[model samples]
Target: MPLLRLLCATLLLAAAAHACRDGGTSGEPPPAGGGGGGGGDGGGDGGGGGGAPTTPGWIERARENFEGGALPASAFAPDPVPDDGPFSDGGAYFTSRGVTPPAAFRATQPFGKDGWLTVESYSRRGDARLADHAEVVADPAGGANHVLRLRSQQHTDGTVVRPTAPLPSRYRVSLRAGFPAFGDGEAGGNNGYDAGDETAGPWWPEERAASQNGFYWLTILDALPRPHNNTWIHHHRKVVIDSDNHHPAWMETWTGDEFVWSGEHPIMMIALDGSRPGDVKTGNAFFSWSNGAWQPSGAIRAVDAYLPDRWYRVTIERDGPRYTLEVSGTFRYGGEGTYRAEIDAAQRCVWHYPVDAAEAAGAAGCVDEGAFVEGHPRWPAGGAWPDWFMFGDPHVNYYEGEVYYDDVVLEVWRD
Candidate 1:
């Protein structure tokens, strides 16, 4: 069953690359590089089954564990505390869509009441009809059994975050997240996922960001206002398409912009930012567990169970220009562990990017090549801080489903 699951996922991965679309930006995956990326060669059972990573001396700056049943005052837009933003008079959002918001929606604040955080989308593209929602609700995965759920059948690309004052260049962010699970029987969600075919090799994850039904694409968590673009973690580093010296050697026709994990796999990809011209913000690592290894064959590795409904915690910490991405958690097909057994984060990887200069400069180098600082002229120096961590189709290419987030936190590294 595990082998079959992995096979089905790989088949879809290649197609996902070409099929994935992009919005709010016109860009393709980084051009093939002079060398293949490193780290894809190493991977193991990942520390025993379960729990989140640990960080010492990191002071928490902002946190949201939606146990209160509503986004706290810290989640809404800043200031004078009025009945707006997430707490609008009601229907404005739906009225724009030509539908009347339920009367009950008018009675209680559905979006949010007050908070230090707010919701924003990287792409302004919004659908009027399908669905659009953001609020706190019950969950079987959250540490507190509650979380902030955001969705947009309209596929309005967005993410939730806490507004803040700029701080030192170094900090860390962590949170628990997962897609909503339905169909208790086929319940875990990955009932019939197919990236297309097995042996197709690792395909670009982010497809064309145009109109999409919204499958969980990629998760971006990193410090913003800095040179490191967290979402860029989805970077394909080098598309390999339209080139001869590509690294993977298997995916030669691929031309997608990001690495799209099919499902049931704790996978990630990275490329050095400046490996080639126009490859700024690219990543330099890939972590798809498979065949008992991370990036076993350079693609994804499925767990013993299903994926869709499983929850996982992701944490990204940045110090200067360097970043570390850590993931933890176990998942069953659904919260009930009915369809299959619990899939521990056994295929997980604790990866750090931008290998040292000498190594990165090597043939299969993994290094960051962007140039920017704490307050570079490119990004405004001071003002309300931008979203530090966001989920739910941030690319604005295409996604029409909802995802949950809980115990979202931002912290500063204590020197």
Candidate 2:
């Protein structure tokens, strides 16, 4: 078997043995944090003093109506046999946070309010088994005072949580996330696996190192409309940050280790379409690891950089097929500033060209050339809006890192 396939088969086997864990294996550092209030003012139909008003009735009633629900014991069956794959790599990792859909909570609709839904109860798939590492703790800043923290030690695991109800199509989601200072083995290092060992024989030298590169992601996902089979489509919009450039070729093949950014910067991306499971075409919008700064992805770029160890308000808004993302805080590149982008959904398509085609003609042999390809579309034509949204890292691997999230709020606009 080819090295890539062999590695994948090994991961699948590993996933089958365990429930999904969260953590990332690719990308560059995220921005530093130290400022207050960044992002564009919510406008269009939901415009207001503080953007669209929070979805009413969601905040006050979420705990009462949404909390305490758990997945069926059957839903927790070993990897791949359950409703979704048992492994935590793709949509399964995101949807499996607390309760799988089709359940009572999964069917709960928005309260028809224009306010925001606040998620207070957070859970992970193997928290009970990994209690020593994954947990929800009080935020040092106080107020609602709770935050979800995920730490990994020889394993690339993470935590996830979902709102009590589904989010509206036209909505703004906001949250605060933080990362610790980079350390050896925290970002990029072999996870104590000897390269020549029998167990490591299936992986390439680079794969072994890259697989242990510690990283984290803050993501938002939605179920796509499957008019073809009346099924569900899973897609992700995520912010990825790695500790260093030592990532697997499969994860960062287009850029490679040479372009790996410092752990302090974060890359924002949206995955639209692809052929393989969880193989969505990823497009970078507002950050780059190549230069250790925020640069434009197409016509969009970050006005400022992000910092580590500090908290910054990250917000995402969708208007029609266009998405506007904003980040505000102290940055290493642009100083106390805000970064923003206005992107169309069609811009996130993954492009393919004939190999051996000339560069002048725009063909670079099957390669992922970034986002905003003019003609290709990620979503199926005339597809319906997504029915669900999820947050957290879904890729499965073994690495070590920590990430924290707090003050998560999602607001929808109803006609």
Candidate 3:
């Protein structure tokens, strides 16, 4: 049964140049690098600077596990919150006060715990009209425990931020915050912020300004497969937004200007507008999760959870390739052994097949099998297929939202 289960589950991996097996020929001169050309290696060659390919280690591991019928049942490795001083997990966390920025913007202060350092927009693409600011600070909560805080607001035109440095691959990111919701429908709602810049290009609407849009709290996983943008991994959580309504908050993950996550590196974006344990759903808080993948993968479950207006800690650790989500110290969703067995027994589900750029470009990569997400409260209605949200444009995504992000940590398993 386990073998059958494993066999039934399809493996979704982004094609990388290294992943593309050489036609099994020795001394083959690699093809010339150019813009929009025919097949070179396999997938990763997505028309970038020299079209750099990715290492094929993780993909190989996934295939080996799947082909063997079931992934090795290793015990869930305990990810202990380190006892080192000053939010120091010793080797667990890398604190960077100096987060690099792109060419258009420079850091007012390198990232640090001393004071609130921020990045302001001076000009974008020779346009001096852009006005936006991002502030980051680290606060010492208790003995050796610190929280990193970030607030980004783009109030005017031509404001944007691309991380100074690329985040390590295969890391989980979660945030805690209160959001002021807006807009009635997905596109019209005043979520919090608006995105208007040249990068958004033709998709940038000069007339219709999107309100209730900006993210008060947003989580992003960086450096995923190209073409399809960030490699998004879905996770399950029993969360109640400020609305106290039963709708699940979206944990959207993306890379750069793209609102897609079909490649790798899934990020988490949750909505905690008005949710408290055993409390009445009062406020109207919400968020959305979307991706470019053909299918999405992850877990979403409920628990007693936490309350708003207070500091709550959410942690997720992947045991091997599987994920485990925890709130405070208890397991709410996605864990192993007792946790995994319980969640699976309670809810049987599947994810959408992540769309592949290589596959789209006619490579022998995995294509979309179907969108069969069970157990999720927001599962699209029966017989209705899940598709991408109409975010105006395809290439440029004006992600404008308001949220406070602190104690940001990322762990990548490259074994």
Candidate achieving the largest TM-score:
2
Q: Write the per-residue lDDT of candidate 2 for residues 1-415, one digit (tens) a residue.
A: 6999999999987875564233333243323432222332221232234454544321211121111222212121123312332211323433334423221101112211232232211112433242333345655456545565645332323233445455555666666766542223223444333331212111112234333333333334443211100011123332222223232222221122233323323333332332222332223232332323334343222133245557776666655445666666666555675556555443433221011113213322213323232332333323233423343432233333465665555655554
Whole-model Cα lDDT of every candidate shown, in order: 0.35, 0.36, 0.25
lDDT of 1 by residue, 5-41 (tens): 9999999876666565532123554345322322111
lDDT of 2 at 193: 31
- Candidate 1 residues lying further than 4 Å off, grouped into runs, are 1-56, 72-116, 121-131, 140-144, 160-167, 181-266, 269-273, 278-306, 331-387
Q: Count backbone clashes in candidate 3.
A: 49
Residue-pair clashes per candidate: 40, 30, 49
The residue-by-residue lDDT of candidate 3 on 23-50, one tens digit each, is 4333565566634444221112232345
Question: What's the lDDT of the predicted structure labeled candidate 3?
Answer: 0.25
Each prediction's RMSD to truth: 23.6, 23.5, 23.3
Ranking by lDDT: 2, 1, 3
Off by over 4 Å in 2: 1-134, 140-144, 181-206, 209-217, 224-264, 269-306, 346-382, 385-389
User: How high a TM-score does candidate 3 get?
Assistant: 0.31
